[model samples]
Target chain A: MSLYIKYPKYLTAGESCVVVEFADEIDRGANDAVMNLKKYLLTQKDISIVECLPTYRSLAVYFDPTVVSADEVINAAKSAPELDGEECASSFTEISIPVCYGGEYGPDIANVAEHAGISEEDVIKRHSSKSCHCYMIGFMPGFAYLGGMDESIATPRLTNPRTVINGGSVGIAGKQTGIYPIDSPGGWQLIGRTPLRLFTPEASRPTLIEAGYEVRFVPVAEEEYKKIEAEVAAGTYKPLITEAK
Target chain B: MELIIRKAGMLTSVQDLGRWGYQSSGVPVAGAMDLPALRIGNVMLGNPEGAAALEVTLLGPEIEVKGTGAAVFAGADLGFSVNGKAVGSWRSVVLKDGDVITFKGPRGKGCRGNLCFAGGVYIPPVMNSCSTYIRAKIGGVEGRALKIGDVIKIGEPAALWKKLEGFCLPEDLDPAQDANAPLAIITGLQEDAFTEEGKKLLFESEYTITAESDRMGCRLEGAKIEHTEKGADIVSDAIPLGAVQIPGHGMPIIMLADRQTTGGYTKIGVLTPLSMEALVQKMPGSKVRFRRADVSEGVAEQMRIKEAVRRAKELRLSHVSRTHSEAPKPLFGHFILTVEGKRYEITCEEI
Candidate 1:
């Protein structure tokens, strides 16, 4: 049976901001509360909120300091609807991203495979078979924190961080798996690569995957990876997005 | 109009009144560190407050004019000269093509120059402002610093430029010498999070600006204020300009124009808007003292200062229209400078 835990009472973040916390302690339930609260707050259009940033277990709502007071934010937040259980269970969209496992694209894949006590092929198959939920966006814009990776492929982060991880590089750190949005420094263990551009400033919605979206991986050959990367760079690669069924 | 950089001073960048309305997207509100001086310099050349100007650091720059121009130097009275002849500050001077403008030396605290043109600098607005933010790579030269050989375009002179005279001035064109004036601060939302002793330390004790001060925030070194609830960890929250935030290490960092939109530190107080201009002008190594003030006091102070500035503008408008009816045309070009040990150049044009 699942247990329901409410967060601490909401408090004024600033003169115009309010933080409605679900829990101070970090846990799966706390994370769920934050996600639910964020989804619920997104539906409340009259709140005059400028931005809503959700973290591991809390959400910060930024409003115009001149327009709304802290007291008003508190009242509005309290009046917001409670989260429904069914929506939480089935709101994510599963997406299959093609990845090229091992070799230069994933230098640490052998290490991860050895640590997981499994063959490299088994590791690739297992990683490609699971559907993961997008938990949050952070570190840089458009980078999503995906939950629900296959336990067989779980690995800790590298002792040293890579100076540059190219965009679309698929990496796993501990239990969290994600893709690099831009060329940035990271400590995640790279197990594969993708041709998808997770973030592009020129795109209408820069972030292709939003929080709560589901993700799946499909293995591709190294040469195929190269072709896809070239096509994406040339602006001709069409992403395989499945239509709503 | 055009100007060539003779010498690029240390940390010189193109600025305006500061970029606003996009702070939510994490873009900084970058502009002049000393805003009053920048505004006056623009106003003197008949440019609006938001006109692009040059933010010159302690070290001045050097440049040569390419066309007729008129510009005024304001703030900190940095020693300035044109073609070996010392120039008077807070006044408009016309420059002919081929004339060299240079900063001779640093004269006082927080030196800046607003070389306004008749039509203002015409740099394309990136994210709605010409202000440069070096980090996060947004605004100004593809979100980068001005390097050597960058050619900046000057705006066309205003249509009503002929009606303006020389640079505007206050009836009392004198500096207020009260270096020890108490900074009025309104207790912030996290005021109660600080100990009473911390409040006393903030208001009573003195602090000096560290060399780490920049457009981001002012790092102060002095008495360490105590936080209440000893080990309480607070989540990050939205921070505004003039906020005095105390991080885990206990020193107070006053947020400035380019500060982050959100911070995890505890903000004990926020400076009154009336004091922000004055505070910005305080040079490095300058001592600052804070004084507790209620919200009403802050509001009243803001009202008084706004009224004073409004009256000053009106008087200057009348004086300019009556005296010199023609725009003080300058020979367009850039001004060069050398401050302390750094070297840089800034563009100058006639408004």
Candidate 2:
């Protein structure tokens, strides 16, 4: 068992905002500290905290300094309750997203496969096998930073980011994988595309997934992918859901 | 009860106090950049503080009133004419059906125009705010800028025959040349990250708002600010209102009403609330200078302003009650009244 150590470092983010750093660098443990603290602080019913946005290694706490002072926040953080060990042990959920790899759906899949010295089939199988954790949300609305990937599949970011990565396009960069919720600029190495509507403004919950959700990928034929896209456009596509423990 | 934009200006959109409480989902707090002026305009019309108003940039479009109405225009003098006849600003004026309202080029640069109808502008509130957010493509009228052929409905006036004389801002109280006004700032969390020289330069230098500025942030171009040492690629953290974040390049970016919830950068200072509202209204290329103020002074000033606003509201209420029963016939009773010791004169018409 890895013993939890309080990562040292605190920096003022803005005039009133404070960031409590959990580690000197990014890692799954650091990510856990942020998530755990976020969950803990959010449960404080009376605290007028504005927001708690978690990142790879820290949870940025925003509050109305007028209502609650920065010193109070620091005190609360130092004595924050310990996280339940079981919560961390809950394996990332198994979510299968049907992806059309290669060709128009995934123009960069073959390139990624070649770069990893693996066959196209091996890339798809390795990618779909393990569930990934939703570390945080940023860069764009509903765009999740997911962790957990077979080390063999890791690759460097592109020299030049694409001017536009369509919504629902799944890509990998370094040790991370993510899905584009909206069409925006990106630099991730695209390996495949999902037909899921990751973000839909008309939906009650616009973002298809949230931080802490698990994700899985499943290979599909191009024709099936096109059909799914059509359903999404028609507002008839329903994400395959599994009850999480 | 309705108005149509016969001619769309450079940019016209519906706004309110702001879309608060929804920053977590990455929603921008889009609202009138000139909030004080917006509030005063609403108060003049006896409308609620959160009433939707129209914010016209630089030049206002020609508007055709479709129904009987009266409205108050506030903020910078956007050159105004009714049927080609020049009129005074900061006062209520009756509009006849088919009356043409046009705003020529602004009298001066860095001026925005606000039109508050006797009745609030009727637009569906998205996420509890009428403010327009162009980026997220949500809120306001279809979550977009006002365009030609858009028919804006108006609600019933809160008070008929109400005069708008005393509530308008007197000429002198208006910031003399608001656009170029030096913004007073309070040092922020990352001020210590920069070298003493960099810190000195921040207050001494003049920065120009770049054309790239928007509701998200106002990017400044000036001497590059440098830190005492190289900084690490920081994990994202919460950002506060008016926080000035300087990334690696040294260009200071002042966050505005629609800024993101979190960011990663070395912050140098934060604009005081009073100055932030004024600075955000400035157009691109407007000159900017920063001055330092301590946090205690900043907080005290905010409290003073808040008390002043409260007093203004109470005085307006008292004036309303005083005029309602014991009455007057001055075509309008226009006099600045004192609230919380700050004075605000108003004009009221009792039929």
Q: What docking grade applies to model 2?
A: acceptable
**How does residue A85 of candidate 2 score in lDDT?**
62
Judge candidate 2 at residue A203 and give its lDDT.
Answer: 53
- Superposed Cα deviation of residue A110, candidate 1 (Å): 4.6
Off by over 4 Å in 1: A1-101, A110-158, A162-180, A185-221, A236-245, B16-48, B69-76, B80-96, B111-118, B162-165, B169-179, B182-204, B225-239, B260-284, B293-320, B323-351
What DockQ does each prediction reach against the true complex?
Answer: 0.16, 0.27
Q: Candidate 2: DockQ?
A: 0.27
Model 2: residues with Cα > 4 Å off, grouped in runs: A1-20, A49-51, A60-79, A91-96, A156-164, A185-187, A223-227, A230-237, A241-245, B80-90, B159-166, B169-182, B315-351
* TM-scores of the models, in the order given: 0.72, 0.83
The digit string of per-residue lDDT tens for model 1 on B1-351 reads: 666767777766778866554443334567766665666566656567568866666666686777866666666656667887767456666667788878876777445555555566678876567888775555655655555566556677543344443445663542222456877777765677788898888888999989898878999989998888843245444466678888867788988877875566778877765466667767788899988776556555544544444554565455444433385654544457889888987544345
Measured with C-alpha atoms, the lDDT of residue B324 in candidate 1 is: 33
lDDT of 1 by residue, A16-64 (tens): 3456666544455556667677667678877777666665556667665
lDDT score, candidate 1: 0.68
* Candidate 2 structure quality by residue, lDDT tens digits, B1-351: 698988889888899977665444545567887776677667657777668988888878888889777777767778766777666456666777888888867776456767888788988787678888777677778888899998999888864324443444445434323555678878756676788888888889999999998777999999888887757235565566788889988889998867776566867767776787678667788888988876655555455444544554555555444443454433454568899999885755556
In candidate 2, how many Å is residue B258 off? Answer: 3.7
- How does candidate 1 fare on TM-score? 0.72
